[model samples]
Target: MPSPMVSIINVSKRFGALQALDEVSLEIPRGAVQCIIGPSGSGKSTLLRCINQLEPTDSGAIFLEDELLGFERKGDKLLELSEGQIAGQRMKTGTVFQRFNLFQHMTARENIVEGPLRVLNRPRGEVMDEAVALLERVGLADKSGAYPAELSGGQQQRVAIARALAMRPKLLLFDEPTSALDPELVGEVLAVMHDLASTGMTMIVVTHELAFARDAASNVVFMDRGRIVEQGLPTTILTEPTEQRTRDFIGAER
Candidate 1:
């Protein structure tokens, strides 16, 4: 078997009295799509945040490829990296949030190229071309000149996806990418993601879309109450879940 591209080892996190993640461990391979599915407040989003280091883990470790994320081992201690260092590490992973966090004033093309120009310091001409290509990839080439307010919810989210791709991340994290979309617009967004999966883009998606998981995911993870209750091949987890909680969740959704 190939080595994992991302690993979470004994990861636990807390916010006040709530344990957002409890000793969760997962290995995500390169060129694989892993979908995390569960009810609300099940720590699905928290886990994604931890992977991107948006949420500092209370214990355990996360690794991307061979490198530790967010912290550095020094002698016998694990010390948090400086803000600058963390930013450098975070550049390898791109996250699309539940809310389409696009800049209201910037056009789609500008939003897509902002990161490369500001953080990577690439030539504007080069970044702009790549940005346009990314917009095209997300099926929004004609909407490149539109600002956030000028686009539909689905269109804005597609632009957000394009902005993340502009970074050329090794791993892409999607947190309920279509949750805010109109029912009619959801398919277009999922189609783009399905296309990405088909092209072997390594992705970890937190979604309620079982059809997407069933058809696109290489693995399905069923999480509840900040812990993984059951996980396996999508066919098994979605069709023949071993745990009652998984069955209940799927049953309720259906």
Candidate 2:
């Protein structure tokens, strides 16, 4: 098999008394839609955060393509990347939160273009062109002129997706993409994600929807209490889980 696009080796993170992650290791190949399902606070979210370096890992190494997301360096080490360097690396992996994090002050188009213009330092005409195309892809072509306040929750989140896509990220990280939507509006947001997945996009999704996991995911990772208890093909993990913890968790949800 070819090498994984992202490699997480011996990763661990702790906060005071709590050990959020414990010697976690995962390999995510390119263009794979991996769904991480677990009870809340089971380290699923923390593992995602660690992959993008959103949360610092006390001991671990994460590799993303040519650069290392987190490198071990200390104790007379010649050089280690500074915080700003790590933040820049983190930006390459776009994140969509449970809450649509669109800026209230900017219009939809503006919000989509903000990161590219400021972070990537692309030319205005080029960035605007890319943003408009992305907005259209996410079904928000007509809403570009509207501000966050003008759009509904679903529309806003779609815009948020466009904003993340506008960066042309190598990987998309979604933390409960549809959790904030109204029950009636969740379908629209999920539809957009399904469309993205169809195009073979590399994505890591944290979701509670079992059907989405079984149908949409290329693989399912079942996590519990700061460790990955089980991971396998969706069919295997969902229907033939080996670990009691994985089966019990899925059983309770059903």
The residue pairs found clashing in candidate 2 are: none
lDDT accuracy of residue 21 in candidate 2: 87
Model 1 local distance difference test score: 0.94
Give lDDT tens digits, candidate 2, residues 1-254. 76677788888888888888888888888899989999998888898888887787787777886567756456745245788887788777988888888999999999999999998899999999888899889888899899999998999999998999888888999998888888888888888999999998889999988888888899899988788898999999999999999999899988
lDDT of 2 at 117: 94
Q: What digit string (tens of lDDT, one per residue) describes model 1 on residues 198-245?
A: 988899999999999999999999999999999999999999999999
Query: Where does candidate 2 have its weakest 10-residue lDDT segment?
Result: 71-80
TM-score of each: 0.98, 0.94
lDDT of each: 0.94, 0.87
Q: Which stretches of candidate 2 lie over 4 Å from their true place?
A: 72-80
Residue pairs in collision within model 1: none
* Worst-scoring 10-residue span by lDDT in model 1: 1-10
User: Which residues of candidate 1, in runs, are more than 4 Å off?
Assistant: none
